[model samples]
Target: MYLYDHYDQAMVDARVAEFRDQTRRRIEGTLSEEKFRPLRLQNGLYLQLHAYMLRVAVPYGTLSGAQMKMLGDIADKYDRGYGHFTTRQNIQYNWIKLEDTPDILADLASVEMHAIQTSGNCIRNISADQYAGATADELIDPRPYAELLRQWSSFHPEFLALPRKFKICVIASDTDRAAMRLHDIGIQIVKNEAGEIGAAFYVGGGMGRTPFIAPLVKAFVPLDELITYSEACLRVYNRYGRRDNKYKARIKILVHELGVDEYRRQVEEEFAHLQTLAIEPPLAELERIKTFFADPAYEAGLSDDLDLSNPAFAAWVKNNTAAHKTPGYAIVNISLKPVKTLADGSKQAGIPGDATGEQIRVMADLAKTYSFDELRVTHTQNIVLPHVRKADLFTVWEKLVAAELAEANLDKITDIIACPGLDYCTLANARSIPVAQKIAERMADKAEEIGELKLKISGCINACGHHHAGHIGILGVDRKGLENYQLLLGGCEGADTSLGKIVGPGFDEDGIVGAVEKATQVYLANKEGEERFLDTYRRIGMNPFKEAIYG
Candidate 1:
């Protein structure tokens, strides 16, 4: 993790003081709600359904054990003794008090974390693969660039009031774990034909009332010009993106209206001018940032083997661990899904990306003991100890089992991605969590048989759960004073990213779960040998599933 320099420290300290005053003014009625709204939003505070919610940033999903422990501490001290880890790789305290926010921000600053850019119509938290540095498939560690972008974009005067809330995601590997294509600006670090490292920029990717997989605006941007090119893209969007309608304000809407080619031309024109303005960060600063993300030392003679004698341990390893770049190490993913049981004496669903305070501390200690004191937050709302030695895999699993964090359902049907729908979100028209729980319970038994299904649920059309990118997408819609969920099929957020198409009519709570199970059953029955759920959907098309659900 990049430790804050003097400048970083000074800025954070200064901001905390500024916000403390702003908060005091709001509470004292010196500042109106209309005026204080943006001020509070920029600082990552939102007045939700029952109380204020505070979202704290986790840059590129990277956090040290100390930072993780601080989050646990914050949850314990200020909120409701738990935090919601979000798809954007941040943490949200749903039960925040207005007066306690400043103190919370201060505590976060002390740990080099903040709520800055976690919300508002500005560049939001920069997300990337949780396994960025440790993944075997990565070409280079991307956190340095993510950190550089983080520093540059934070409070940048140019983008402080963009057309809408903009998001940027980065990925170094070919696998699109961060949903790079579905961001306002998605940058993939790539090696060109000449073997020079550069970025492939994807613009206009987003999901809301309108969903778009960002097209490749520019094939390649040189390493030195990453900042300049990014500024160019932002400058174009900031200037041309529609402000008349909030729904169409995202860059994706702009790209859609203007077409990708015209958008590319505009970005290029801006890039040409921005380059001359010396928008690139100093090379020394980048190099200095890189040093902070270098791989930790691995011990010799560490064996790349796990004792699978325990069937339970074997199940967890099969689902939660990934191959590591290092010879004797493994990447371990922790499931934060709180278990639910059905009324019929069967298992139910789970919360997609939530961890209790105790679980946070346990994970922090696990990272310290097994993963070089570093941990990562996955986009799917799980935790990753990206460099656990394979020899200690069972030990880690045992600890996780004790904490109830080892669920053995990474990409399975039970591993759902759900937004805090009507339960916590004021924008939501329907309930998402209960629906997610129901669906998970319905599909829990056939997890492996179904295989690699990315099920996502969103409370409303904001697509916070990334329902647009799920293999089985569930969108909660308000129907005549009742909650109804509409199902979708064939969505993917990967190297081959595509948005899902809605399937027929919306279903009531129980009906929706049954619909999802029927959709999966359709896949399981028709799928060829070893075909994943998405694979089957892609192969056979939506007709089969649609027929099953609607008929």
Candidate 2:
């Protein structure tokens, strides 16, 4: 985790003071709501359906145990008893008081965290692979580059008021855990034939009503020109991105309107101009940032072994853990979507990504005791103890089981990622959480049978839940003033990124759940040995699933 220096501390403190005054003025009726809108949005405050929602940034999805604890404390003291971890790897408090927001900001500042850029039409939180440093597959830890971009994008005067909200993702691995291609700017740190490291840029990828998998804009950009090239990309978007209509303001829209070749040409022209200005951060600064991310001290000669005798623990280890770069260490993913049995003897799904304050505190404690005192929030709305030792797997499992956090469903159907739909977001057309819960409940018994299915839901076309990337996606919409659900299939967010396509006619809430189950049955019946739902869908295509669901 990157510790804030005096300058960073001063900037956050100053923002808190400024926002406090802004909030006070709004409460006292001195500042009109129209005037307060941008000010509050710049600080990551949104007036939601019922109350204000505060989004706090977890940059690059990395957090120290102390920071995690503070987030829990804020949930307990300021808002309700829980917080929703978002697809952006940030956390949101739904019910916030206008006056108490400053105090909350101050609390966050104390832990070197803030709400800046978590909202607004600016470069939002820079995201990366959750298992960045610890994972065995990455070419390099992508967080450093992500952090570099973060510092560059934060309050950059040029992009503060882009036509629409922009997002950027950095990844070093060929496997795209962070949905790299589905961002406004996706940078994959790469090594060329010369063994020199650089970046490959993918531009104009996004999902809203109009979903697109960004085209590769540049094959290789040298490390020295990384920031320069990034600025060029943003400059091109800012210069020509749509502003007349909010609906078409995303960079993706611009790229669509202006072909990828022209977009690349403009970016290249801007890059040539930026090169002379020397805007790229000095090599020393990046080196300084790299120092903060050096691997934690580890005991040598640790055995790379786990005794998975207990069936329950063994299941958890197999499902919840990923191979680590270091011997005897594993990347442990904590699933927040555990199923709950109600008093009526029916199972209900725990809201995906919702964690109570106590649960957050427990996760922090687990990180402190078992991992390396560090936790990561995944873009999938889960948490990761990125460097847990294999020897302590049982104890970690025991504690998580005690806390009811040990759900061995990673990439499984039950591990769904969904957004707060009509429940919290005013822009939503229909409720998403209930639909997600229903689907989870319907599929819980067959989760193992279904296998490695990624399901996502969104209340609207904003794609905040990343429904566009799911193997099976559920989108809630309004039809004839009634809530309706649309099912999408064959989408993926991995290295081979693709947007899901709607299968057939929309269904009511119950109908949608049944339709999803039917689709799964189609998969189980037609799937070859060890084929994932996605594989079978691609092999068999949408017609079989469509016929099964709609008929």
On lDDT, the leading prediction is 2
lDDT of 1 by residue, 439-526 (tens): 7776777887888999999989999989999998999988998888899888999988989999889989999999998998898789
Q: Model 1: clashing residue pairs?
A: 348-441
TM-scores for every candidate against the unseen true structure: 0.98, 0.98
What are the candidates' C-alpha RMSDs? 1.3, 1.1
Off by more than 4 A, model 1: 338-345
Candidate 2 clashes between residue pairs 3 or more apart in a chain or in different chains: none
lDDT of 2 by residue, 301-381 (tens): 789888988998998998899999889888999999998767997897899999999999999999998887999999889
